[model samples]
Target: MADFTSRRTLVLRRFARNRFAVASLILLVLLFVGCYTLPAVLPYSYEDLDFTALLQPPSARHWLGTNALGQDLLAQILRGMQKSMLIGVCVAVISTGIAATVGSVSGYFGGWRDRVLMWLVDLLLVVPSFILIAIVTPRTKDSANIVMLVLLLAGFGWMVSSRMVRGMTMSLREREFIRAARYMGVSSRRIIVGHVVPNVASILIIDAALNVASAILAETGLSFLGFGIQPPDVSLGTLIANGTQSATTFPWVFLFPAGCWC
Candidate 1:
């Protein structure tokens, strides 16, 4: 417990010393708070149409201006941000969990387990995930299908991370602690959970962060192409795609959402 505490403290200290990471974290936190909280106080909802304010630039009455349909840009941007953030976070966590479980199990118990898991990973690695997702996501038009979108994103995203975890676990399984746990008659599950997984957590943490960005971009791309999030639902990609037509005349529509997405 003491060792774990010291390790955690050291990690926190290291994180704090990194100015970019700290700033990024602060900005992310603020964005999250703003996206969720500011919407209630805003005069317009994403769905509200204001025919009078169509294509209007940023102004006091319509803070981020109105889109072609007269929908408030700020309201839509915040709503889009909320959806994008949720999808990104959910996909990252689910994918990382799947990777860690499959990789650790495969590495700790070799032979058939390793062969099957690695074979699955290789198969997925070769499959065109983007094409598959694009083909399937459009079919799911209901608002409830957002969960399906998240699952699909996570399903196709874990292969590379699983391979990395498998390699790390292969080395970790042979370490003294792992060997000692085995000799003491600890269950394979406990040894993997308590000993092996914790050791490789650093890599998993990094992978999850990268996955968040990857998932968000993947979603944005799909949404831009009109296959993701669907109509009546807002996302940064959809906003950007919608904004592109009038980009020359009404730059605010594109810029505000694009900036929020970035």
Candidate 2:
């Protein structure tokens, strides 16, 4: 209990000292809240467009002004944030989970399993991730299809996490506590879940946050290129792409979405 309390206190103190992490956390929370509330409360749907109001400047009625299609820019931006964040989170979770699990098991077990998994990881690392995503996306156009694409992105992206976790597991598996647990007949699953996972969770969390940012950027790139989230679904990338032609004349078109991304 004392040890647990000490660790908890340490975490709190570390978080307190880490201003960037705290700020990022706050931003993350605000983004999530915006994603949930903005779409529901918005004056118009993302697809609702009025050509008559095209390219209007920001005003009380149209908060961020109207796009070429005269859709409410603020509403589209809010909805786009939702979609971008959703994709980012999904990719991060799926990728990290797969990587962590495979890495932990391989590192703990060793032998042929480790060799084979590491080989696969190396193979994935050698290939171009964006190319793979482009190739896989057109196979379907449903939400499930987009989700599958995200998963595929995650799967290919896990090599870094796998290597990191494997190294940590190598050191951890040799520790006195691990040996003691083993001698006490703790099952492998218990040792991994109750001990290893908890110990490595902090690193995993940091990596996951970084990975989320990367995934969002990746999705944005794909969408900008006309391959990511489809129409009726306005991602930041798609919004930027839509506004690219008139960037000089209507800078708000790209500026608004890009601001949200930053």
Candidate 3:
């Protein structure tokens, strides 16, 4: 526990030392708070339609404007942001957990295990993940599409991270401490959990941060292609897709959502 606290403090200090990282973290926290809270305070909900305001431009009443369907653009974008953040955070954590576990296990117990895991990793690396997700996502029930999409994105997202973990674990396993733990009769699982995983955590932290954006973009692309969050449930991708038709005439339809995405 003491060691863990020290490590965490060190990490916090390291992160705080970077201006861009601090700014990004603040912005992310604000985004999360705003996305979840502001909607409740706003008069318009994403589902609330105002036929009178159809394709309206930004005004005091409707900050971002209204879509062709008469839905409030600000509400829709905030709702979409909530969904995207959920998916991005979930995919990043799950995928990174999967990668760390798989890589640590494979590297710690080399030979056939390593070979098989590496082979699987290589296989997934080559497969057309986006196409497969696109084909399968449409078939999922609307209620569970977001959940299914997160699973699919995570399923294919961990291969590279796992491979990186494997390499790191391989090097760590031969270190003096690892052998000392083995000689002291510590179980393989405990050693991996307590030592291996922690040592590789720096990389995992970086990967997870990167994965958040990657997952969000993946969800956006899939949704834009019409395979992501289904109707009645708005996502940034869906908003962009819906707005694409009126992009030239009603640039707010496209620009607001796209800008939020960026």
Q: Which prediction has the highest lDDT against the true structure?
A: 3
Winner by TM-score: 3
Task: Name the weakest run of 10 consecutive residues (lDDT summed) in model 3.
Answer: 138-147
Q: Could you tell me the lDDT of residue 160 within candidate 3?
A: 94
- TM values, all candidates: 0.89, 0.89, 0.91
Task: Name the lDDT value of residue 185 in candidate 2.
Answer: 100
* Better model by TM-score: candidate 1 vs candidate 3: 3
Tens digits of per-residue lDDT for model 3 on 1-262?
9977876776666666767656765776788789999999999999999999988999999999998888899999999999998899899999999999999999999999999999999999999999998988873336576678889999999999999999999999999999999999999999998789877776787778778889999998888887788677889998999989999999999999999898
Candidate 3 deviates by what RMSD? 2.1
Instruction: Estimate every model's Cα lDDT from 0 to 1.
Output: 0.87, 0.82, 0.88
lDDT of 2 at 114: 92
Model 1 clashing residue pairs (backbone): none
Ordered from best to worst lDDT, the candidate numbers read 3, 1, 2
- What value of lDDT does candidate 1 attain over all alpha carbons? 0.87
In model 2, which residue pairs have backbone atoms overlapping below 3 Å?
A: none
How many steric clashes does model 2 contain? 0
Candidate 2 at residue 244, lDDT? 87
Kindly report which residue stretches of model 1 are placed more than 4 angstroms away from their true locations once superposed: 1-27
**Candidate 2 residue spans exceeding 4 A from truth:** 1-19, 139-141
